[model samples]
Target chain A: MNKSIGFLGPKGTFSHEAVEGYRSGQNKAYELKEYHSIKDVLCALKDGEVDEAIVPIENSLEGAVNVTLDVLAKEEDMFIVDEFIIPVNLNLVAKQGTKAEDIKVLMSHPQPLGQCRNYLNTNFPGVVQLEENSTSKAAQKVVDGDGTCAAITSKIAAKIYGLEVLETNIQDNENNHTRFVIIARSLKAKTGADKTSIVFSTDNKPGSLYRVLDIFSLWDINMTRIESRPSKSALGQYIFFVDIDGHIEDPDVHDALTMVKRKTSFYKFLGSYPAFAGKI
Target chain B: MNKSIGFLGPKGTFSHEAVEGYRSGQNKAYELKEYHSIKDVLCALKDGEVDEAIVPIENSLEGAVNVTLDVLAKEEDMFIVDEFIIPVNLNLVAKQGTKAEDIKVLMSHPQPLGQCRNYLNTNFPGVVQLEENSTSKAAQKVVDGDGTCAAITSKIAAKIYGLEVLETNIQDNENNHTRFVIIARSLKAKTGADKTSIVFSTDNKPGSLYRVLDIFSLWDINMTRIESRPSKSALGQYIFFVDIDGHIEDPDVHDALTMVKRKTSFYKFLGSYPAFAGKI
Candidate 1:
């Protein structure tokens, strides 16, 4: 029996696209399931409802997805097995025969709406904007609603929902992209060009984080991204999420993480996975 | 002559509370104006619609309020004139005759809705939750709608909107607090106990950020907080928002930031204002 994979979806979401991308690279056919929320998608995998789960971790335009990072940090027995990057191409999509001028209400997940802020302000100023859980759900709303509604969503979502694309590349930034990760019960083997992600909180001291970063620098490791999320216990406390080049299998990477684990008050190694080298 | 202050408001939101707190500490009376969004509030200040604007900068539970930070970073001539911290006390409010059991739908701004997730999960289970622009707006919605509606809003909002408190302190964390900042056209004079906030983007190279952080460490400057936001240019590129303990008038802080500016590709000096030391 093939393993089942879970994604955040009502179908036609970017997470659904990531699932399709993952499937294309795999040798064996796998079952796919859609969970409504990112937390639900990860929890389903942990609960054995699925063997793998894919969810977005970061966007070029929107820094870190805090809920995803928070869930990954809090949950035990979860590891990233792969990584994927997808360019966010937002389109003004509506029902067939609906003109752009007729769009009185625009809808999307808050992200795409924000990504298209300039476009929306320029093209549809004063239009009522609504938020949905997913861009695909927004597309679904456009399909179900009266002719005055449109959604800023992926092309796949428009096609899947049988909506017409009224405008294309509606995002404010051409470089907009989202990075997604595949989470599993265990980590994957080293793929040479891989990245390791970890979350750790330091003692409430001035130079504590710098000391931790010094360890990576001393080991000649390259950090690709760094983000800080509030620890939720208090105002100033934070957990640092960092992605660095090299997998745990690398000798330097192994040594540096061992040092990092010992130095930090709290630490969690999220995973080591092959880095996505596609157009980001 | 009295100055005018602006805030993101519908008359009874937490921003309204922040404005009240600020007014209490002032020596002069000021005219208060309300803007619909964070950007609008800040832009109003920049556009000379108000002499100052108060906006939430960070929450103990939710971390940084990105819109406020992004707007401050992008706009010119905006400076932090003051800072205020208020404990976020969320209440479940409804019409006077409505009971907790009568609520079929709940409403609040997305932030408060998220802050009360566990509480809602335990109490309401699957109540239909709606999002409004502000908590006060949510309270107003409860007032205009049928009796079977409730809002998670501040105590002031419940009173102003003439709603009954069904439950008090519905937030998940007791430590929930939001920090608001007063932005003006000019910076405040240095107070001995002050914090300078700056946003800078380092070259996308290994050890580049570590070196910039090294400046603070070298000057013995204490950094209170550090957060990364996307540069909005590309993936893996980030602009860092840092709050350090000391005003620009402090020699060490001045020297460290001067070094930081010289080292970074892009830099912006947000402001230096007296640190809020009342409570965490």
Candidate 2:
């Protein structure tokens, strides 16, 4: 039997697009499964229902997808095996015979609505904006609702729902993109160009986090990103998430992470994966 | 003439409660105004429509409130003059005659829905969950709908909407709290116990952020929190938000900030304000 992969989907979402892109780039064909939510996809992978799972980690316009980050940090044995970046191109989609001027209500997932804030404010200032669980769901709602309803969703979603594309590229920033990561129960073999992601919490003292960063600095490792999330233990306490260049197999990267593990009160090695190489 | 304050409100949301707490602690009574959104409240402060505005900056369980951070980063002349922390107490409320078992649909803002995830899953596994703009809005929706609808909202919202409490303290985490910041045109006077928040972007090079944090380490200042948001210009580029102990009036903080401004390509001084004193 071919290996199976899980993704958050109803067939027309960004995660589905990412899975298609991932499949096109791979040598072997894999069985694909669609889960309802990010957590369901990840949990399916953890429970051995699928060989791998793909979920979005961050978006240029919206910042980190907190649920993805939270799950990765909280779950054990979940490792990132690959990454892909997809440009987010939002469109005003509606039922057949509907024009842009006919849109009395706009609907989408909150993130897309926010990304297209400027466009919506200028084009349909008084239209009611509603939130759906996903962009695809928004498109589905438009299909089921009156012709006056429109959805801000991907081109694929509009196509799948047989909706007219009233307008395209409606996001405020043309450079908008989302980064998705493929996760599995075990680590992937390190490619020459790879990134290691980790989450850790330092002691409640002056310069504790600075010292952890100092290890990366001292080892001359280049960190691509850093973010902090509340630890949930208290208001002031936080857990730091950092992504650095180089694979764990590299001597310096290995040494730096080993030191980081020793220095922090809590540590979790998320994964070492081949970094997304394409430009936004 | 009395000064006026602005908040994101329908009179029963958490921001409304924060403003009420702030007003009671103030020396003089201020006229209160309710805005439909966080951005509107902050923009009103910048445009001189209100003397001050209060908005939630971070939550213990859900993490940083991105809209508040984005507005503070994008807008000029907004300063943090005060801070308040509110314990999040989620309740299941419905019409007077509604019973707990009668709730066919659960409604709330996304944050509250997330905070009460475990509670809802265990108690109302098959119930439909809906999202509203605010917890108060969810309460209002329940009142406007059939008795089978229930809202996961604050006590204030239940009282204002004249709903009966089906259950109380439904959030998974008892320690969940949200931190709200009061923004004004100018900085507040330095209290001995204070915090200065600043946002900056470091050069896209190895150890650039480390060197900036090194200054805080060198000055013996404690950083209470640090978070990064995408620059939106490109992937892997970020701007950081940091809160540190001490007022900007202190020699160490002033010198550290001056150096930070000189080191980074972009810098913004959010403000110096007395830190919230109460324990969570």
Candidate 3:
């Protein structure tokens, strides 16, 4: 489908990198739009400015990307259609001619900041820490300044801004990975390696939740992740985010999820998408 | 309580701030202890080096604090008791004589990097950004560097480091809050306004979770927060972390939670503690 995918930020952000994952010749044949923030991207999708949008849902290191989840929970019309697990290679990018020793500050998004800690402390010893919209924004700041400044961003950001890469793959852990989801106006195509996401609330009885989980066990479908967000109604109330292996079109998946819908006080289907986690 | 609390670092870290809220001075007296790293603090608590530990579970602006949560979820026997919400104020603290412009580098915990985005971009602009364990550790780094640098930290951290505050409450959103839970060697003594936390997994089926939620709705009892961590067992399984209003000792609350225990494949109570959120 030719969908204009909207994502958060300018040229060098990770979301931009993730959007790149979806753009095979098939997807790039369509238009692409970029926004400066998650809210803007969501708004663009809601306003019908884009056929679909990509927003980060979580990171292995950081956990839930709450912004997208919170909005999707409230935006009744939207649903996730596809997802990508991008292996993040955060770099320490700096303006041309800035020596590593000359750098006194390190700037990047907060998640990258934590992901790159061991290198910074051991190398710079005591440099200033700063924040930016995304790693690419940090690269832009360094490009604009052209001083001892440097930024931790994706290699793509460095290439985008014509900056030199001071360090490659500087994340504290080499296994850094981020998961992004593609959201659409409604459910569409399904890939078999697909995973279905749903939100449901269990009644507060002892065996109620156990009984709910039993359905999947009985059907023999696999659940990958399960998370809960506050129902925001009152104390003692919560809604859960769950992931199961297999597409909704698959009989077992559909049968199990349908059964859950009947018992839950609250329920919503997020989507069924192939788990496209590319290797680093 | 007479329990000694272990946090991430020596002084003025987010854990220290969380301690302020989690500590009720109930059992005996709560003593604050500092560690150089999160692992150390948790290991200490697990080893009986400390009575209880205060750890950050999630950040509202940035999302889940994975490092802490992952460890808590993986480690058995230990569980969450109660949680408190604390506002994260990232301040630019420098030596008494240093001016904002004179500040060459900024330092802070990696997490706060995003929280102070607009301020860092506008004021320090292109200055180097560095990351440390927490705002407190960042302050110590700046202090060690003499007048050459400044750190972004809690005001309390500034006092601990004997640094003057260059900027106050430098966070992106005024509503930025962090929810921290107290994990102890065993269950805790009850404080007024107590909240109960539990973990459970339901059979994977339709309406399984719904039946569980119905327990509380029927009781008119309120739940505060609910989160699910992958059971990371046997595959296709999950266990949820749920916090609810009223002490476990309260009849309705006890009844509701007790019934929920039977509905899932697994269930564990984190704890109950006084809701220490004092003033907004």
Among all candidates shown, the one with the greatest lDDT? 2
> Candidate 3, residues A1-280: lDDT per residue as tens digits?
6658898878778898778766762435756798866756887889999998988887665556666776777678888888776778888888887799899878887778767766776887667767665787788888888488999988888998999987798776666677788888888787667888888888866545555677787788765676666554433345668888889899888888999999888788888877764553
Give residue A265's error in model 3 in angstroms. 2.4
Q: What would the per-residue lDDT of candidate 1 be over residues B212-231, giving only the tens digit for each residue?
A: 99999999988889999999
Q: lDDT of each structure?
A: 0.88, 0.89, 0.74
Clashing pairs in 1: none
TM-score: the better of candidates 1 and 2: 2
A259-280 per-residue lDDT for model 1 (tens digits): 9999999999999998887655
RMSD of every prediction: 1.9, 1.6, 7.4
Interface RMSD of each: 1.5, 1.4, 6.7
Candidate 1 C-alpha error for residue A266, in Å: 0.7
lDDT of 2 by residue, A162-207 (tens): 9999888989999899999999999989889899999999998888
At residue A180, give the lDDT of candidate 2.
Answer: 95
TM-score of each: 0.96, 0.97, 0.66
User: Chain B alone, TM-score of each model?
Assistant: 0.97, 0.96, 0.79
Q: What is the lDDT of residue A144 in candidate 2?
A: 91
lDDT of 3 at B125: 66
Error of 3 at A5 (Å): 1.6
**Would you give the TM-score of chain B in model 3?**
0.79
lDDT of 2 by residue, B2-112 (tens): 989999888899988988988888899889999877777887898899999999999999898888999889888889999999898999899998888888888887788
